[model samples]
Target chain A: MPEPVEIGRLTFTEAEIRRFAGAFDPQGFHVDPEAARQSPFGGLVASGWHVVCAWMGAFVRAHPSAADSPVDHPSVIAPVGVGFGLQGLEWKAPVRAGDTLVFFTQVLEARASGSRPGWSVFHRRNSARREDGVEVMAFELRHMAPDPAPGRG
Target chain B: MPDFFYEDFVVGEVKAFGSHTITEEEIVTFAREFDPQPMHTDAAAGAKSVLGGLSASGWHSCAIMMRLICDGFLLRTAGMGSPGVTENSWLAPVRPGDVLTLRRTVLEARTSKSRPEMGLVTFKFELVKADKTVAVSQTCLIMIGRRNPGARLA
Candidate 1:
């Protein structure tokens, strides 16, 4: 197992949250301030999907491995990899607008696929916490990473 | 139409949701901002990669699915909120010019043990192409308000 990666912090504004929700989520508690205040959450909260997107943005910024090259194509940036699936995703807390969160990801397991010789499967967990350190969301993500080393095939 | 309450969902019934046409420009734009992988952002680069051609980010597919769900049902339903996804899979590549539709199936429905005012419904969603290819599949749990909050328990 490799070291855990701390993807940097992110903050969502009311305008940004509203824009994303208006286009994607559109729940009253996510898009309308007055309606949100009357809703159960009592405030404009970011969509769980929006929180995941922000975490992806943070992941892209922190990982230098985007520049890593495969043995065959030393000049090409390694592919971003393909997702296999996600499991056990839990939204533990609501994220209101103006909340700043720090995100982190860790590779839990990795092994070359026995059926597909040139591909490696990675199981990873991603999570986010508020600036005060309360966990807001967590999920497991699985992806197929192309083998960088040669000779297995 | 009135909003749906706890008893509205029927298990074993299939509900069809949305229709959206995929576009190359939107795919690239979304990728540049969120995913940014060569396979998703650059057409030529993607053709050269194992994915074979430009493809929409799986997250983008999820976003589209959310829009469909809201427009199809959630907007008018007595929707409380959701905990999160139980699982999701990208079954096939989503390419430009593919007209996508979503279908939902009610797998389970039950009143919440503690929160009697709301009920939990588990749904299986499949985002399908015009040719009937399933591009994405997911299982999600949602909380819906009960029409009669205390009637069943009482």
Candidate 2:
């Protein structure tokens, strides 16, 4: 079993939550603090997508080799390639503004891709917990990465 | 207060929504903050990558799909929230300038055994391009409030 790697921590501010939600979600509970108080969530909450994106942001930034590489550099290899899909995504708890979340990813399986030459597939379990230790979100992500073996496709 | 309630969704019902156009600026901006791979952030690097040209990150496509869902009927529905997504697939790269639409189908609906006030609705959501190609698809269960929780079946 591969050990879990910490992605990094993130604090969800009201402004950032509102900004992201305004663009992609626009739900009252996410974008409007006052309106949210009148709803079931009881306060301004981050969109579920925002929380997922935060995990991605932290994961990309934490990659040792991919970090600090110029965006235009041709030789810059990303830590992971395009994702095939995700499964069993869960939002267990509400991520309200001012909450800080710690993220982690653990590799569940890895193998050569049968269909995509020169690429390998990785199945990983990604999760996040609030500062209070409540697990806020989790999902199984499948992505492809180029095989590192020399002379491989 | 909303037009749609748990009782409103009929299994196998299909609905279409959205006509949002993906833009290069939005794709780059979203990627710069989240995914940030070369193919998603830089046009030149994208041209050199396997994705062929500048493309929206898969997560961005999901976000866009969420927006379409909200605009479609979620906002006017008694949508409590989603427990999770059972599956999400990125079928094709979403390129800039591609107009996307959402095709939503209700797969199943059942009243919650634990919470009679709410019901669980399973849906298959597809984000389709103008050419009818599905770029992304997701299957998930959402909790919706029942319009009349105390009503009895005849």
Candidate 3:
């Protein structure tokens, strides 16, 4: 098994939370501070989707190889691909404004795709924790990447 | 006082709602901030990718689905938020200009044993194209407050 990679951190600012939520979610606890204070959360909270998007941003930025390679010719170190799905996505704790989250990704398994030629499927566990070390979110992501070793497939 | 509560969700009920047309500008804007993958952000790069063309990030599609859900029924219900999604799948690429709609089904509804004030409803949500192609499907559990606590407890 490969070592887990620390994808880096993100600080969820109030403005960022509100802007992202306003454009996509618009839930009371996410978009409006006053309305959020009256909601069950009792204060503005970042949308779960926003947190996931932050993780993705961090992950992609951490691997600069993805940006260097063309789509048809993927980097061996960072074979870019699209996510097929996710499972067991859990928001264990609320992420409030100003909370800094540290993200990590661990590859669980990888196998050549049976359906798609020259493509490999990766199952990875992605997670985020607050600066205090409390786990806040977790999910298993499935994505397809170009196989580094083509003839083997 | 929400219009719908835990007691209102019946198992096996199905409903369809939403009509969102994705735009290339929005797709590029969203991708530049989040995914940033070539297939999602650059048209020329996307044409060279296995996806065939500029496609919205899968996360973008999920966000769109959330907006549809909020507008369709969640905003009117006594929603307590969701713990997590059991499963989610992107069955097809969500290209720009695609008219997406939502199809929701109540797979299960059960009162919480520990939290009597709320119930858990399992839902299967599908983001379908205008032509009936399902682009994304998700199964998740949501917590909804009961209209009256312990009113139906056996």
List ranges where model 2 is wrong by over 4 Å. Answer: A66-77, A115-118, A147-153
Model 3 agreement with the true structure over B1-154: per-residue lDDT tens digits: 6899998988999999888999999999998999877777888777777878888888999999999998999888888878999999999988989999999999999997788889999999999998899999999899999999877755
Lowest lDDT 10-residue stretch of candidate 2 chain B: B145-154
Error of 3 at B87 (Å): 0.1
Q: Write the per-residue lDDT of candidate 2 for residues B1-154, one digit (tens) a residue.
A: 7899988899899999978998999999999999977778888878877788888999999999999999999999988888989999999999999999999999998886678888899999999999999999999899898899856543
Tell me the lDDT of candidate 3.
0.87
Q: Write the per-residue lDDT of candidate 2 for residues A1-153, one digit (tens) a residue.
A: 998788899999999999999988887888988889987789888989999999998887776563344433332544567898999999999998789999999999999889978677899999999988899999999998755434222
Q: Between the candidate structures 1 and 3, which one is better when assessed by TM-score?
A: 3
Alpha-carbon runs more than 4 Å astray in model 1: A1-3, A65-78, A115-118, A147-153
What proportion of the real contacts between chains A and B does each prediction keep? 0.67, 0.76, 0.71
TM-score values for chain B across all models: 0.95, 0.97, 0.97
What lDDT score belongs to each candidate, Candidate 1 first? 0.83, 0.87, 0.87
Extract clashing residue pairs from model 3.
none
Top model number, DockQ: 2
Residue B78, model 1: lDDT of 85
